[model samples]
Target: MASVWAITLLGPARQRRSHNDDDHHTSKEEDIDLGPEPCIFTSTIPAWNCRNLERLASKTVSPLVFAHVRASTEGALADSNCHPFSRGALMWMHNGGIGGWKLGVKRRLVSDVGDRWFEAVGGSTDSEWAFALFLDSLERLGVDADDEVRQRDGFGHVVLRKAMLRAIERINGFIAALPAETREQGDVRCLLNFAVTDGKSVVCTRYVSSRTDEAASLFFSSGTSWKMQPSSETGKGAGKTQLGTGEYKMERRDRGADIVLVASEPLTFERDNWVTVPTNSVLTIHNQTVLIHPILDQYYNHTPSFLRSRGFAIAQGQTAEDRKAAITRENSAAALDGTAKEVAVA
Candidate 1:
């Protein structure tokens, strides 16, 4: 499954530059500061590589940063198809798919977007088109995506949130409009874990557009610092060839979320530091306050203990370990059902 990670540093400004001198030919390094403002960096390369990442990360520290690694089920793998898409001052990333994208819905999805946003689409990914729709929504709401005035004014949390919700609604509407035969074949269930920021505030969501199927796995970890754990104590990578090639941990001295990290899987095995973002909920991080809201739709499930099968998620190329976990969960559910039936007979 696709994964996304973000960090919001809530203090001080730092100076940094891109590692690619040639790529920076069009834009100057000074023009990309995160001081009292938001700046984002995204790469198609797997998170572990991209040498510029370490260089920029080590020097350019900000209160907010986001990263995503994609496992494409609906999109092609290319540099432009990567996450962390930005338009003007808005930076957006998504780790899920738009259900029924291939089955004629692609035309509808693109047609709804405005000409400007439509032209901005660079890659053949549904995710990019989704971003276009988001931009169109913002523009339709009278906040021009490319307007400097709007960027300076800031879209505000309300506008951004509403536009995001509208984007999801539009996708659902398109899926609903599809013929029954097409719907059955396409398996039009969506997993929409998204993160958006303006270098000032961050809003994220963990949602699935199905009542009986699980969304792509998304888990969040927050703490004062994310650091390499003591390898000696954990007996992991103590004798490794590399110095910093060890497992990391989320260290929390207090309840305050100084740094927030969200991903499809826990970056490290520090179980106590991470929490599962409940399905169909939006996790908003505004000024360090984390708020979660349920995304209510026809596919939404209200029951507390209701479990969505993860088989579809696994088949879409989730890690083997995660697939095994889903199998274990299915077995657990089966056993529980058996016990309930026996008790009813007794």
Candidate 2:
């Protein structure tokens, strides 16, 4: 089961896609400006109507953006199991599952959150639970998770980044608290590729709980416009082809990024147009500028030119053709914030 979520922040033309629909074949949306750009729309039907979505996509244009299509690893098929869960102006989504979710990790997570966040979890997936934990972390940090003021004024990218890191830390705590027998025999390393946005700034993380293993795949592309080639040149129609099938390029006429895109995989075969968000790092897209910050934790490996095994991501069908080469940059994880030669992500 895959889930899709999109937000289009536009300076001139902004509209929100609502989750409520009148029927199976029809979709619903509103033109009211919520001051947060738009409401996230999601669907969980096994079959996707690409044409319908393309029609909607063609009509809407955005500036600040985020999206996700999830393949569940630990939940039943249902609408609530989709990505892009929301509360007020905040939207969240996750790729990958909690390690030891079946061994009472989910219970531990639920028990740790407050009553409001706990009762708000509508899905049974660990991904949604992680979102609740994120809201909890924000509240604990003195930021009101449900306050409309923060939503309108923007939950600073730094705030979201710290809360996201703390949420992952809490998740690690849950897995660590599992019984000794469960820990000894279980596959406890988690892949937590997370994305969160409050309609202004965006923050995302590509991480794994193990130092030597790779997390699920995450790639980012930044440029002026995500334009598609003429169908005659690439045999792919522009704006008509669905997300991953379109032949697209990042037109870099200048250094200022007019558009920023992050995906579980590259949407096109354009290699120079995309860069790998270094594993165990946080990527922030604020003011259309991209910043990469390494996640320093116990699972963080600082070995220069260290290679992470692709076996885990491969098993989940998330491997890329140049997967091994993605992390070949010389600077080690520990030196991300220190004195080290910087590697250009684009």
Candidate 3:
């Protein structure tokens, strides 16, 4: 499993705008350090004092936060490769791998996007290129992805959501465009779990291109507060609450969702507090309200009670369990390598 590292924090708004006068909160960039190790130093993470992490988390307060732990499958371990990549206002992070990358999907993705989006790419990961494709998709939709005004005024939830769905559609197009033999070269089945935001509204997806195969793990937890419990273990600091390496839970005093967290896996072992965002669905968070929508496409399985084979997801270490009905479905289900039995539509 790749060690979790990268994080993005959107601070309180710095200026007020009328379009978003409902609550009137501005946004700014707070402290952000992503990667297994910060790039500015001559050392690695183990060399840094653990207290530094505690202090950083304690002092920072942001409404929109994105933390990603990645194991590089396509790109090298450089700081620029750390996700939550941004253009003007849009920021993105992705989990899982792009299928058939080495064959021709990389070339196809690079050639498919416009020059503006192409020039904006700075890293060598399928994730970054996906961001570029997103930017390109936004541009093609007559929405300037880098428009300063839209970046500030909020990129309306519908625009952002549609762009995200289109981006995934574009990815599928590229993969499908490959030669039949080339497509079968590498693992051509993609696990596209993405988190994207325009500072205000957030859109996340848990999708695999195959109808019968499960995508990578994606679980979301929402509550009134993500508070720390009184710990039985204490540290040296007196009267100061310690940020444990493992101690937190979702406390729901009411139905209102004040804080929502989406991760490739659950943040804690509080199973009841978290809900699995359904596969091939989009989750949108606006004004702290979550709405889930199904991404109905050709790969979509219409069976409401269909159980996705978790073998592919578990093999990637994305999920802890293989939740399929029985192991006998291996011949009946889709594999991560892009092989699948025909999906019957109801």
Candidate order by TM-score, highest to lowest? 2, 1, 3
TM-scores of the candidates are 0.80, 0.81, 0.79
Candidate 3 residue lDDT tens string, 1-346: 1222333334224433334334657544443323121111111132234455455656665566666655657777666776667775577888887887888888999998999889988879899898888888888889997666776667888998898999999889988998898876777888888888877788999999898788887788998888767654446565655455457889989999999898877778778887888889999999898999999998789998777777677667666444443344554545644675543211
Name the better of 2 and 3 by lDDT. Answer: 2
Candidate with best lDDT = 2
lDDT (C-alpha) at residue 109 in model 3: 92
lDDT of 2 by residue, 1-346 (tens): 6666567453334447676655786677777654654556666643265465566667765666566665666677777777778887788878777888888888899999999999999988888899999999999999998787776768899999999999999999998888899887877888898888887788999999998778888889988888776543245554453444356778889887888888888888877788998889999988888899999999899996776666566655565645345434324552664755433332
Whole-model lDDT values for every prediction: 0.71, 0.78, 0.74
Ranking by lDDT: 2, 3, 1
The digit string of per-residue lDDT tens for model 1 on 227-342 reads 77543334664564433657787888998888887777878866777788777777777766777788887877988888667766666653223555667777778688774211
lDDT (Cα, 0-100) at 188 in candidate 1: 84
Clashing pairs in 3: 4-69, 5-69, 13-26, 13-27
Q: Decide which is better by TM-score, 1 or 3.
A: 1
Worst 10 residues of 1 by lDDT: 337-346
Winner by TM-score: 2
Candidate 2 backbone clash number:
0
